[model samples]
Target chain A: MKSKITRIIILLSYSFVNLYLIVTKKILKYVHPKIIPIIVISIIIMSIASMILILNIKIENHNKSKKNMYIIFIIPIAMILFIPFKQSECLNTNFTVTQNISIDNKEFESAGKQSISNNDVMNSKEIDINEVIENNKLDEKIKELILENDVIVVTDNNFVKWMDELYENKIYENKEIQITGFAYKESNFSKSEFVIARYIMVCCAAHMAVGGLMCNYMADDIQQDSWYNISGTIKYETYDGETLPIIKVNKAVETETPSVEYVYPY
Target chain B: MYKNKAKNTTLHNLTLIIITLSFGYLLGHLIVYIGFDQVSRTVKIFSTKFTSIIIEALPFLLIGSFISSLLHVFVPIDTLVKIFPENKFTGTLFAVVAGVFVPLCDCAIIPIAMRLIKKEVPVHIAITFMLAAPIVNPISIMSTLFAFSGKTNIAIIRVLFGIIISISVGFLFSLLVKNKEIINDKNYCSHCTINLNNTVWDKINELFLHTSEEFFNIGKYVITGIFISTIFQMMFDSIGLNNISISNNHALLLMLLFAFCISACSNSDAFIARGLMNSFPFGSIIGFLVFGPMLDLKNILVLNKYFKRHVLIIFTITLVLLTYTIVSIAFF
Candidate 1:
């Protein structure tokens, strides 16, 4: 059986952890900013509640089984402090990105159809890519970069949308591009092929999904989890019967992993 | 006798602290020796998801516990009974309306509902409040509106479906289960006597005492639910359901399953649903938005802990059928 003090300490410890997360600004990595104020209020209420519990500790409620359950609360604290904080790229092994690029004419359909189709559901509008780009009113620098055609850079902000555009329009036929990401190799892929991937985190590391373009390079020694800066040109490839955007590398150099590992969804 | 009890409690507490410290040391050594590389990535994903779920829900859990404390200590149970109308239909309707006003998250709703049920509120009404409050609230509405900005119909459909389904389920539960107490033996303490004439300080102390006790008791369930949900998410992610090609109906099933496992907050689920707008059908996306806030991995555990096994099962099955039917019919 545990005493009231033990219960109080457990509650206080949780409050302490929240305070720690709030102070360290690590809470943002796990939750949206909208919940931060709530977290702060929780800390205040929890700490006050803990103090009150301490002041009025009793000896009557000593159920051994219930006391044992309090141990579970310690897991979160242990996870945050003891576990080595690393990128969630561990999900690369099984994580799958949507690779099918079905340019449809029904872009203005009232509702999204299923990714697969048996009949005319798959048909979509063939909108002009250049006109769409012009209408988007992208930043002048990004516009210049995309038109550079020789060494276009794909940052986190424009990676997914840009890729989607290039895939839809098939404009990156032979345009050179430079991108930086960690290497991920699928089980079926050869040693010469890897995915240069980044996690686009919408909510937290747990909710992060993989976002990257496939790469075809000639480095058998490229290790998994190693970050690289690869200058490559676009190459269309059919892997496992699905056509996808593959970067044919011109130059590859090892680079330090970015401090902010995960990119937010644009 | 009192002195002996106090001494024994202190000794037991000390022993607990020692044991906890020892476990911590062993765990620390294990993590260091194995390192993250040796440890399976699946485990890290599980831990990361579990941690995020708990951290994300912690604030709401605290708020719910606090609200439960205030209700138990300050508010009288009979007052709740008085406010609820006599007709079961109106009562359920009242619950749905009231649910919209209180913008509690799923994590916050259970504790408050437990308190309500303890106060002799109708089981159906409490269930209505529990299921509806999370989705029908203002914050969720705003987020849904923002997420489906151009397509205002989706947001409206989400809110309307949330209310209709919740109220109908409340009626169904009302039919199956009577207005009896649904809280389990562990938490129901209505028989305990209270001294209303106690001083303000004593009342404050009593309030905090009950608050802390309830928090500790329920917090365990929250953590357990999160752990299980995280493992479920890891498995789901590993399966890579998104990669598969399926018909719209099958896609809805997969999405419903996904929503149950993911257990994202109602306020943020809109964003996730929006993200899926490109790949999944609109009906399935609606299913994701509607079904998740109402029933998910964590809240299932909470509901299981409080309600009878039969009642919980009935609620789950009923909610799933109703949500899927309404969404599919409306969209398809």
Candidate 2:
């Protein structure tokens, strides 16, 4: 009788974790939409099984020692209940602040140089702006950005790719780009320079990486880790003896943070 | 005498209720304090990463357990034995292809594989299924392809490499393992697989019973694995592994270790691999793609419940050497 109760409690807890993920809407933060069906199906199957097992609790008692292992399963329950969708205070706190500010200029230069040399053969010729336009399967927002006469909105989805292309091909050097993101500055950055960035998420929040573009604007108004909208023309600037594209900001406005903190990859 | 016995039982129940309520009250207070007030940075970071991993992985683990239960209840031993080829080469080869057919996650494949082994399926073939299914599954391959931005070559290479390592390891284990009993407990099979030839309702009940059994049995190790790997990832990230300049071989070694330590699900591991693409060499990334799903901090603990010490050692060594050799030859 004791074992039966333990088994029911354990099985329900397993079911509850999946059900909790669905209820709290925290499931979206973890997996892609394509995998949702499988997740739902699994939850239903497990829940049904748990209910069936409870009805017919004729399980032969196994090793008594194994009962101790069941205690560990409660960790997920505790985590889900206590910390569901809560932001970590340490995320943008002092330690991260210090780490973000203490950047190595030489390392950036080397990284920039390494990328140029490594992909020189692959992208030797200039990239055709028409080629990107010709790709019909591209996101409509990106297509709209391309179709705009001179100004382009660098959204969270297209920010990383746009920056990579602008860095490599240098075709959009003179076009005015409008981008909005939080301000991030490295130690090596000058007072007038910072990055407009968002965390790029390819799979889940756990695998997110920082993706942003360099901006040269007045730093007095923009605070670290605060959101802002900046309109700027693209230009190659020599910083710390390395030449890379930077947005020469024409206007800056403080803005509220976006609902979605992380940017999904396009 | 009867009145005294009833009074004793009533006292026991009351004590249990009182203790539970007090514990709940304390726990609620503690959580409220932590949520509102400040805590150490390490504690916050650990909680965030730990929750993220468990949340992301629970679905896969559920799917795995569900499949394992289905296999335990429905899949007959004769059906498997008959389908298994007589030739050892074909048998191992079939194991590799069989993974593609089942298309389950790493966490789910172990219970099914263990069941097969208990059913007297060739131990090495079952091992092959265990290693290859996580990597070679259609869902994983599709996700890998998508993650690499439609790079079919990388996806194909990962699948091919997974097959090669899985086959070699399977064959090696077949030669090395003398005993057929892989599980530690001998009586585990008797209760789990019994009542198979019963009425339909009884069979259905047994299915759920066995699934619940299999899930709870393997679920603890997974939680332990996740806790350890989360700490490992946090330390590696905070320490800034990318800051160090590493040689190609050195990077490969580091990446392989990272793959083992992080133990990200195979479906999403490609995204993690792609994230590391610009910083690390292609070979090291490929090494990570191949090595991670086959073995990681969590699955290793899960595997320990089944395989012997020497078998695991052989499995690990053979996979590492073969994967390194193949990746080195291809890229370097």
Candidate 3:
């Protein structure tokens, strides 16, 4: 009982919403960069599909009860295209740095055995981060940069790997460190101290976890959602029975938030 | 008279669309601007996270629909049957292996698997494809590899357990539903049944037609699914699951249920599991990785569209129990 053109309009909307996201680059906020290639492929496919649909039209019959199905697409498509919402950086709930990891050698060895046993069927060795970053993720540029400058300056590119270097701060104990992250304060923390952190997006914003070094600063001007540049010396101390690095800030200054807030591993 | 009638309906539809869109737009602005201090933040998170899932899976759904449409138009049903072994055991086994190669996520696999069922392919074979396709694909395995970088055992165990659970569940269906009615109505369309007289161009036209049709058809279910799962995501956020502590077995059970509720795509579910792995035991994170793809809030609703009510009930129970028993025995 419906015109075939009605269905064509719905189908073309499919192509439009996808195309709108890709062209606007609004999709970057939701998905990881690696997903873009497949999205482009899909856009191309949808274009051809809608083009063909426009060319070939017919008066198709349908039950009147089926009309409500068309309404389901409206709200989501509109929300996607028009809504002024961003995934908040306040997603510190799913993330907790302290963990009970099984570091004992017994469980580690058995885990290795079981991996090999199951992977015999696969016969493929997936290149993990360790393999790609052979030298503990310290590439020549970073190493040279560290050697040249007394202070180790971390950019967005090296933020994740360099922060990871905090776990073993043997080499960089006395090295002056400069980094930038948003201010995160816990109610239990001392008034002069807070965690300077940025969200480390694993696959997308949905899976982002906060990663940053703790800063012991005596500043009262720190604001939420504002970026801060902290220059300090790497100070290692035992906290909660574990040796951890805390930045002893000599200077802390508020700065404008960067264009891209979330950092991805890829 | 006919032309005028058609014209009026078209105008009516356009007016209807404008009203709905304007209403939706105003509603969105209201949610963002007009709200309680905490209410706005929850809504903000819900919208962004909900879209991330839909946008992330959109490409796969598009490609899956295209490939499935190609099969519907170009490939004959006989070819689909002949490609698989006629024997039940071999057919089910082959389907599970074939599932690993197809590389569609749980959401994308539904249309293909249901189409196979409609084409009179064995229910067990199609069911196997639906259950196992997402868990062992190349992209998923690579993601798992990266997520559990130092501990590759979790990645391998996920794939291993996925295949085992898939085969067992497929066999379970074969035994339980053999010689029983799965689909009550068999009056689905097959205009191309007389494609013998159609040209290649005609077949290609049919291909695009099916593609467009399938996109919208599957989309309704997908959007509905996204809505339900987002609601659940917001609920969990409010309840605050992080502070609670339970026994080892209870944690595993909770994780399985969480996987079903969140309805994350299989490829990205590994990353979510990684975040939780720091808190939960290694086995429960693996349970989240394994149980999620086989069944979820979204796919279960979509599955209801093609399957009978009782069939879905048993299917869900079988998958959950099989996944729980296998994962606990293997990892715990």
* Candidate that would win on DockQ: 2
Q: In model 1 chain B, where is the ten-residue run with the lowest total lDDT?
A: B183-192
Under the 3 Å rule for N, CA and C atoms, how many clashes does model 2 have?
Answer: 2
* Model 3 DockQ vs. reference: 0.26
Residue B324 CA error for candidate 2 (Å)? Answer: 3.1
Across residues B217-271, which tens digit of lDDT does each residue of candidate 1 receive? 5676677666655555545544544446678888889889888877777876776
**Stretch of 10 with least lDDT, candidate 1 chain A:** A107-116
**Where in model 3 is the C-alpha error above 4 Å?**
A1-3, A62-65, A87-153, A163-165, A168-172, B1-35, B85-96, B119-122, B183-197
**Model 3: per-residue lDDT, tens digit, B22-69?**
446536646766666444555556566666777777678877878878
Error of 1 at B269 (Å): 4.0
For all candidates in order, the CA lDDT equals: 0.67, 0.67, 0.67
Task: Rate residue B320 of model 2 by lDDT.
Answer: 83
DockQ, candidate no. 1: 0.23
* Per-residue accuracy of model 3 over A79-167 as CA lDDT, tens digit each: 67665555443343332111111122111111211222222222233446534553443454246345337777877777765665554
Q: What does the i-RMS of model 1 come to?
A: 7.0
Which pairs of residues collide in model 2?
A: A101-A187, B64-B108
Model 1 Cα RMSD, 1 decimal? 8.3
